[model samples]
Target: MDEVAGAIADPVRREILVLLRDSRLSAGEIAGRFEISRPAVSRHLRVLRECGLVRDEVVGRQRFYLLDPAPLADLAGWLGALLRPSGWEHHLDALETEVHRTRRERRADRREENTA
Candidate 1:
């Protein structure tokens, strides 16, 4: 779980996962989308592979990467268990909605005050 979290904590790795979610891609293809070097992208791929979030296959001379998704499922299950038992997630969601509403109301009030 720690490894999975660590792998996904990086924005670049998350984007990589998004890219691979739809289709498999070669290392060069993945690297092409970013400004980073091929080696840097390879390192991100390595971390994802280590965390079981991605898998690579050697086809011909190039390596292709695809999302495994099992580890993410496991993480989701773990988080669901933690959130459901305590009911904290429900409370958090409610609080978030309330905060958004309050912010919107404040903005409206300020606009009216300025117009007046």
Candidate 2:
């Protein structure tokens, strides 16, 4: 998981993963999409490969890379859990609304008493 996190920490590597998400691309194809040098793209690809986020296959002398989302599942699940609202959230929101309503009612009562 650490390796996966580190691998995606780079913007270049993240872009590479996005490029490979829907379709496999040869090293040259992937490199061509970026303004950086082919070697630089290759280095990013190496990090992704090491992290199991991508898999490369040799076909007709061209190495093609594709996304392997299995490793990301754990990270995604963790993030989802963090983003999900806790059970207390609804209760807290309700309590806040009730407090505001009670304050408004008390202010109204005070106004009525003062008017009387």
Q: Which stretches of candidate 1 lie above 4 Å from their native place?
A: 85-116
How far residue 94's Cα lies from its native spot in candidate 2, in Å, is 10
Writing each residue's lDDT as its tens digit, candidate 2 over 1-116 gives 77898898899999999999899999999999999999899889989998899999999888999999999988989889999778899789889999999999999999999999
Residue 113 displacement in candidate 1 (angstroms): 54
Candidate 2 ranges beyond 4 A from true positions: 90-116
Residue pairs in collision within model 1: none
Report how far residue 26 has shifted in candidate 1, in Å.
Answer: 0.2
Model 1 residue 105 lDDT?
100
Model 1 error, position 93 (Å): 14
lDDT, residue 4, model 2: 90
**In model 1, where is the ten-residue run with the lowest total lDDT?**
81-90
TM-score of 1: 0.69
RMSD of each: 8.8, 6.4
Could you tell me every candidate's TM-score relative to the true structure? 0.69, 0.75
Q: Per-residue lDDT tens digits of candidate 1, residues 48-94?
A: 99999999999999889999999988789888887673577789988
